[model samples]
Target: MGAEQIRRWESGALAHAVTDPFGQGPLPWLRGSEHYVDATGQVVPWYAEPDRDRGARGPRTADDVHRQIKGFAASGAVAPGQAIDFHITVDPPQQFSVDIYRIGHYAGAGAFKIITSPRLAGIVQPAPLAADRTVSCHHWWLSWRLQVPSHWAVGAHVAVLTTADGYRSHIPFTVRDDRPADLLLVLPDITWQAYNLYPEDGRTGASFYHAWDDNGRLLGERDAAVTVSFDRPYAGAGLPLHVGHAYDFIRWAERYGYDIAYADARDLHAGRVDATRYRGLVFPGHDEYWSVPMRRTVESARDQGTSLVFLSANSLYWQVELGPSPSGVPDRLLSCRKRRGPGKASLWREIDRAEQQLLGIQYAGQVPEPHPLVVRNAEHWLWEATGAGEGDELTGLVAGEADRYFPRTALPEHRRRILLAHSPYRDGSGALRHQETSLYRAPSGALVFASGTFAWSPALDRPGHVDSRIQRATANLLDRICKRD
Candidate 1:
């Protein structure tokens, strides 16, 4: 598309502007892969292709174990008409193809296949270059450059890279738009990059949280990276560890026809997004990292009556700063000392900015195993239906890391505060701990909710993990946020 055409599409001035077609009934354009049909029946799938092989599991070879086909997006997100570069490396030097899919509720098809690249030769890129406590691939060769189509819908997207030998991996990125929507879904891209230990060959992989000693002994925060780069692929299969949490929420929300826009966390730090423009800002995954500007913006938005929803635990815990890439692309480097260091990087709580002061509840402890989510304020509007009552326990609803209200912490002033779920779980040390899901109405009439468990979003849509009551409760919260209730 030409520059003017792309601009028109982004400005929503095109004759057939892309839109969320879910829950709009089965229109003629929804038939087949074409989610949007323009005049003269020009159909655009917009990455809505189902039945494409998205699996990366196969028999392993020396090349697969040592260096399988893997890649990373040059940027965490790209707007329509912008070109995104994929840096990929394939072992044994083989040809590969990339299939791009936009993730959403496509009438329950899960994703739409938007683009497929012609087969291209792939080469093993250079090894990761290690700097002071950091590993980066800024020198890797660009394998593919995709110019995002102007009419592509805004949502979470993934690129599946498959080699001639059937080895596959994924590269995830977001297609963003500048238009306003009822709610903004910000993916935890910074946290994803923080936990990525690329080149996990048992020798030189290091995230901001963990690393391996020269003797291959696993080391903790002390030996971890003080800074992490966005230029390297995620360890293992190139997928972020907690990405499914965000995807599950997206599938459920889109299925219900919520008006949602997507962006990466870095977008908030870069001031590319205006949180105040939306009714609610949704963080639907393991969003554990935060920059000063990001926190200030979200908090400022809340003070202005924009609701904030955190669907998982341990959010805004660590403070981070963004830096330019070695090549000077802004906000490509994430620096968090996680302790007293040369820069202002530490836990927000340690700096007297306890997350509870904003979230109403703060990180408490980790759940060693799944535990029932014991309902507390069952009479609250958040639990209006789905047959939940006080003391009712949703089996295995509380797991992974969790949060709870801290009595001594400086809490956010609110018109009303409620503890929705109080669940007991044993920690790794066999100590008794409790997790509490919280909801508080800010003085500005904005609602802030903390799910207090990592499993909340998974229960929204993941098969074998879905819970109707939890789903209903989440819908209630979101509906209230959008004033649809």
Candidate 2:
């Protein structure tokens, strides 16, 4: 319901305690500071309630930045015995202790830590250059490598780097799981990094849609981040967006003892997954940016009978390219050329790959106000045992963002087509429209389900704000799908 409640539930998903949940300890650069920036103009101090000066930036001592730590890799995943890279900023070069803890339910103690890397030492250096200078891409030099112990269980790992004086910052990554399971959950790492407004300056600190110039004008197609890198810390959460949405889905799945593996979007782009090994592949939340290869792989898997679930809205919309990162890793540099032309790479619609054709629904625009989802086809198998009926309202299910069916678009072949929720929304042009949550069966016997809203996953946790109707609906589907697979 509330942010703190969602966080407590997530924190309990862990088994035991290691350290207090990672926080911004002693870091001086904060997003809500008073500062302003102008294109071709100087940086000045300015703070306004409306944040009228979008790119306004404040001053930071070089020493304050030196104490910050940033982990850089295309994905947080690293195999046991594998080493991950991270950077640190501290003035005059001092030795700091590096600790690695696996964040998971340890025997039900909730978010406990096991000392994977205990008391390791490294020299902290000056913070990396903010490469773009205008954007928040911090190209911190590689400070150290953390090798995972071969015996550690596969889960999310948080790297806590602390100076001798105890100043600290948390860097998070995942331990790769190559094992087969009935379901695989993908944390939208690429999308998260794309939206992260680290060093939250108004002008240069944005993803494709996050830019605002000093004049309070949104960045144009060309001015937006043409290329974004992963070599930086998230402005908050160590991950962008939430511990409650996708992360909560993870806790729910795990708490129930469902067999699941974790990976990021890059794994899909790189063809690292044997999708056939699992019954379903899940895109957890706010999964927007996609590469050509990522789409092809997911499409192929779905056509071959593997179930695909998108637990969030605004998915597979933008077509981006992952260029070479500075570290020579592919898919590190996210490029979105949101424009029209023969050579232009932008939205999926512009490239003629309309996501609706595969998803059976397209972006209808976003629902601004919190509203209820009107169930359109309650008899559908997904509604089994939920006691829902046609015309019944599912409160708080339509929120944050939403998508509606595109009539003119070609949809995949299906035996049973059902619209679960019919809710209203407005497009970027602010025209009144609606979003629909739909389900259909493919020719190959695959079942495709899209939650059609960003709020769906949080609803799964039944956070007091929403009822158990959503929770019951999700469990019914997950049980049937995993059992069949």
Candidate 3:
């Protein structure tokens, strides 16, 4: 059957299938069997049909050995009635099709198929242009152009690319709308590009974090790219390294029917979004890269009574500058020299604008292993219904990177501040380190929350990592933020 035909058949079958209250489908990991009511009061199923073949081989590193097919969206996001381009490359050039899916909590199917493209001829695009520590594919041929349907809802979307032989990959983007919502979820597209080691063929791939030497030895930060372009596909399966963190939050938040709008981080940096229009702004992933305008706008929003939510650790750490692509598309190139260049290319803290001053807590250190999240200030409104008490420990809730309050740094002068979690974990060297989840109320009565650990969002929806306490606590925070004075 044709791709579109198959999509129709599966969708029809799902609509008639007995509803699974738990939302667990045949592929429990990828498909959900439950249903939930949306903000519009319509019942939606959370059922994402699993791909027969995802083409993902194992751990995807900077060096992606299985490069059957890959692609990238010309823009990280597009609004309804706008058109976006997909630049794709296929090894052993063959025909392929693109299937679009909107990622959400569709009654437990993690995603809902929106449309599918007919078979289109595919070919290998030109190689990347490397210069001055930057690898760019600004010259790649456009594989497809999608004029977004005006009826599509604003949310996180992905285009799945499948070759004739079934080699598949994905390209994630956001469908944004101008209409205001109670909460705005900003995807960290800038950080996604910062860590994208495209063409991860070992010889020429370069991201802001790392690159490979001529002899194929992985080089660290000192030798990494100072500038990274968004014109190339992401390494491995074409998904951003920490994208799942944001997806987890989206699924969990949507399941609860939160009135959330979506935007790309680039939209914030380019002055395309009015942050003050929303009651809250959420950064749902490892949003490490920031431009001057992005920081200033968010800070201004907070001062204007717009709350802020950082769901992951290590946020707003590296200060960057977004420039135009070689083709002059605005905000397509990200540059952060990270102490190697002059001006705003260093850490925000080095520029005397410590992240803690805005986030309530700044990056502390990496957690080599999962540790318990010890509850503090459990009586606070943020922990209202979680049944958590002081000194209660949530196992495996603190891992990956973490943040903590620094006494010496200039901090935000909030009317009230509280540390929600104060857990201690050993570092790689076995030295003791503490991670603190924090919340503070600004003079404008806007609340700023920092999860202080990368695992917080994943705990909300990721299988085997879901923690009911975290989910309830997050709901409490958002509910309070969305409430008007």
> Against the true structure, whose TM-score is highest?
3
On TM-score, the stronger of 1 and 2 is 1
Q: Candidate 2, which ten residues in sequence have the lowest lDDT sum?
A: 13-22
Question: Tens digits of per-residue lDDT for model 1 on 357-476?
Answer: 999999986776788999997899999997899999998888878899999999998999999999998887899999999999999999999999988988887766789999999899
TM-scores of all candidate predictions against the true structure: 0.86, 0.78, 0.87
Residue 448 displacement in candidate 3 (angstroms): 0.4
Global local distance difference test of model 1: 0.80
lDDT of 2 by residue, 1-485 (tens): 22222232122112111111211222211222334564436555321122225543332221122334334443457777887777655443555665666544344322445664445445544433444432423455666766667987776656655555434556667777788988887777778766655533333345554444565343534555666777666543244544346654665566677778777788888877678778888876778888899889888988898888888778898988887766576666777767623477678986688888778787765565656788887887788788889888777677767777888778878877777888765544678777798777888888889888877776654234445777778777778779743
Candidate 3: residue 479 lDDT (0-100): 88
Put the candidates in TM-score order, highest first: 3, 1, 2
Candidate 1 — which residues are off by over 4 angstroms? 1-65, 340-345
Displacement of residue 87 (Cα, Å) in model 1 is 1.2
Worst 10 contiguous positions by lDDT, candidate 3: 16-25
Clashes of 3: 14
